[model samples]
Target: MINKRLTFCHENWSLREPFRISRGVKTCADVIHVAINCDQVTGQGESVPYARYGETTESVLDQIEEVLPEVEGGTNPEELLELLPAGAARNAVDCALWDLMARWQGRSVPELFGLEVQRELETAITIGLDTPEKMAKKARMNRRAPLLKVKLDQENILDRVRAVRIQAPESRIILDPNESWNMDILRLVDEELAGLGIDLLEQPLPAGQDDGLREYRPKVPVCADESCHTSQDLPALTGKYQYINIKLDKTGGLTEAVRLRELALGQGFGLMVGCMVATSLSMAPAILLCSGADFIDLDGPWWMAKDREDGFNIQNGIIRNISGNLWGGTEKAEAAVS
Candidate 1:
């Protein structure tokens, strides 16, 4: 048996600016970095603890600690799903195990799963919630971006989206209400949002309260974010959402995320791969699922004040390349993290 060791710690990276969503504002991304060492090789993964899912830095660390012995004792990602429910803790460990296995076999994670990596992926540049004029200003700045994800809330929904649509007329726009809107408000702005050329509407209604969606069909395609976590949640989401946003943090890790993608596709649900405001380490694993994704929102690293060295190169909403030294690649060892 190979001797495996596990080490993890909490890290906080400051954002370039306040990232506001329907829930609240975040100036720093609190993440947990997990490293597994075996046979003189090391694998690493990162996860963000989101309070919206009842997760905090302390809770995530404690959860990882609970499984430390099992993880070091050769617990694989498949067994990990039975150990922990889908969440941030499992996400960190599952991804690390995948990295470790890939390194052990002298292959990249995508190769291990028989996936061909895309040289370039067009991602969505996110514009956080702010005043209408401010949002428009941000949109204008990123007008050249291929896709723009605009955050909104119940207040001034039409004004904010319209402002962004006008500023970035050529950009494909996705409106993310983040579960802040109800059916009444959705009906109120559905026509105007479509007229503004909005491409997608994400999680407009709060989870468990989205039954109204089954009866009301909007002009724009709707996606489920907060409403869907794992494959178990997919059945109920049918007829309620046109697309499902897959985030590793929500699915526990790439292991389950890949399964969720296949299952969602089989069920006729469109796929959107997204990420929390984290470093490239967290985004790297999720990149494996972007091959057939309808929308890619892995622009988390772009919001950071500084990212890891050899991180993803993202410009104008396009991810040019993911360095080999980054997570899940076979070309080099794990990138140094400070």
Candidate 2:
């Protein structure tokens, strides 16, 4: 006789505060959290939409429901891989299996994936889109983080950087325009930012317009985010971007992310391991990519009003697992989630 199957569910989460960027976001987030329960173990994953990318949690949850029958009927994660293409659904299932397997077998998921545990990492604190003054204030507050990822738009770009630089004069800085930049603004600000001690500039040009970058000369190194999704995006970015920001959600999950890393590095591209707004579980898998990354910007959960009970602890720009469960902290997490 076959054993009883597990339970599955997905829900929405709201950010404690609106996370503003160059585009327009002024309120709570509609996040999707996927949970899988089996026996005494449970695994969870989170997914967020990039409206610019045309994704929504409702659509993602609907996609999961479409596959609910198969998931309930003992379809394994490996099977889910072939049945479903990479996206939020496959990512949730893949990570849920990683968690379940780790718990049921008393092994750590990273170990299963052949990744070593990192004791410490210097993450880039995100300076949300704001006035030059407010952005600088945020940057000043986290000056000790060693690195800062400044979010910007086409408007008042110089003013914002000037303010932030005054406060965190010595902090290594990088800029993420999120494809809000055009050739005019990009070329216009390159010299100012390069002079301001900005080490790298991220996604200065729009995704489809990256072809223009071929003839362009950057004042600083340009890392690809929106322009670099899967490994297939690598060839197109050649000679255009010096680095690629690898987010698990964008690549689908940890499995494909690893493959994308190898392909990008082999083709001579730098790497930045990033994340959507997610709890530690989702960020943990991306840490592997950080092993060789030039920059680490995994500050997704920091914006949460109340992180999951057993979530990661952020202190002075470093992340540490508190519960010590196979995936993260369980005692603290279980007590909170339970």
Candidate 3:
């Protein structure tokens, strides 16, 4: 037991603009930020409660508050896996623990895991769900981005994707319906998706409705977002999804995310590292898992009105690593603590 203290608070970050998906719209990102201080070093983590996963901001805060005693008493991150179920609450506490451990060991999580941190991670800039014309204008503005994730719904799916494809002709597109599409819509747009140069289609149909994908093959690779969580989901996702979007919030933090990635790869599923709208504190841990991922959507901070100081830099479409004790990197952590 290293001398430790646990503290948490809820933060609400107003987005520069409202971000919309099929389920709802968010004008701000509400997250729980947890900081663990072991000795003199303080490490931070953040988790956004997703309504899709049955979590609200208040519920997440309450969940963390419930475990304060155990966390302060010296519960390690590995032990945390047994404490909470996989969701936003566990994600906040688990990552905080990882951050604390990294600071204590004087190593970044990636270095601790013997993984090379990729200097530049190419991330897909998201164009949230909106009218085709508005979405197209947004796409044109980000034309320099190499990849564009176009959020869609049941209505005007082809028009929106086509509009973005036309505006950003060079960008590889990922169409994320966010479980708003049906088999008919998928069938209707099957051929056009490949023509529109959509490299990946994410969570087209609602969960449990995905069994249709077992036999219904399409030209574009379909990635699972809503359908997959941890390694336990691999069996159900097998033969249905070609890719799995891994988010720390969904996997209960980097611990399970790393495990899920290894298991997913062994099962022959392509990997994608993603994030909800969050700050760099949340994105930092996910960056460690970005190695060899087929797609990276950790651009949550890009949509924010402001970001933490020393946050990751986005030059063109490439997200460069940050140099600070934001979450990882021992030298930076030491500098921050000292």
Candidate 4:
């Protein structure tokens, strides 16, 4: 049996700018960092508290504390599934275990999971909900990026899309309403958004209120973010959502996230790997899931004022390589030239 020192801490990272969704606005990212010290090697992971899921920093910390005894007594990642419900707390502990196990076995997490570590990935930069001119300015700044994820709310839907489209004419656009739209709003934007060169629409209506999507199909592929969390969600999301966004924070960790991806693929759902505004520690493990994703939204760290040491290399819109020793392997992975 292996004994490990399990510990968790809460850290708040100030975002470079305020990020807004359908729910609210946030100026900082409150994250829980978990570390497992086994023998001589130490592994680390991070999870951002998501209010949309009714999660708070204090609540997640308590959840980790509840399972500390078992975690320190050599409970592996697989066993953690039964111990905690899928959420931010379990995600931190599970990823920490995976990181520790990878180092102990002398293999990277991707290699251990039988995945080829992606060398270059095109990730969508997020433009938070704001005034049309402001959002358009943000889009103009990132016009060189290959993909831009525009955050929308109930108001300024068309204005936001039109402004961003004019500013970043060549960039592929995706809309993430974050469950702020109703049937009327969806009906209102249908014709215009279809011609706005948008590639995807995410969570237009509130979860459980999205049954209307079954009868209405828009020109752009619609994705599920707040609605789909685990593999169990794939069944109900069949006709409603053409794509599903996979975030480790939502699925608990990479263990379940990988499982969700396989099941999602089996169900003919397009996969999009996303992340919250956390650190490199959180985003490191998620990079492996972007292998064949139709859209990648791992720009959480880009919104931070400063990220953890040796973060992923992002140039324009492309994420070139995973940096640092956050996950498996050495401090630096061989990066392709940008």
Clashing pairs in 1: 91-252
Q: Residue 200, candidate 4: how far off, in angstroms?
A: 0.3
Model 2 scores worst on lDDT over the 10 consecutive residues at 329-338
User: Looking at model 4, which ten-residue stretch has the lowest summed lDDT?
Assistant: 329-338
TM-score of 2: 0.89
**Candidate 2 wrong stretches, greater than 4 Å:** 1-16, 73-78, 322-338
Alpha-carbon TM-score of each model against the true structure = 0.97, 0.89, 0.96, 0.96
The clash numbers for all candidates, in the given order, read: 1, 3, 0, 1
Best by TM-score: 1
Tens-place lDDT per residue, model 3, 241-313, is 9999999999998889999988998889998989999888889888767777989998988878998877778
Q: Quote the positional error of residue 185 for candidate 2 in Å.
A: 1.5
lDDT of 1 at 137: 99
Tens digit per residue, CA lDDT, model 2, 1-338: 02324344554456666778777774554556666666656766666655666666666777777777776666766677666666666677666666666666656655566655575687888888988878877887898878888988888988988898888887888888888888888888888888988888988878998787888778799999988777878888998998999987787767678889989888888889888776676676677677788898887777776666666777667877634363532343233322
Assess candidate 4 and give its TM-score to the true structure.
0.96
- Give lDDT for model 2: 0.74
Q: Write the per-residue lDDT of candidate 4 for residues 107-156, one digit (tens) a residue.
A: 67776677766667889999989999999999999999999999998898
As a whole number from 0 to 100, the lDDT of residue 158 in candidate 3 is 86
Candidate 1 at 144: error in angstroms? 0.5
Using lDDT as the measure, the top candidate is 1
lDDT of each: 0.91, 0.74, 0.86, 0.87
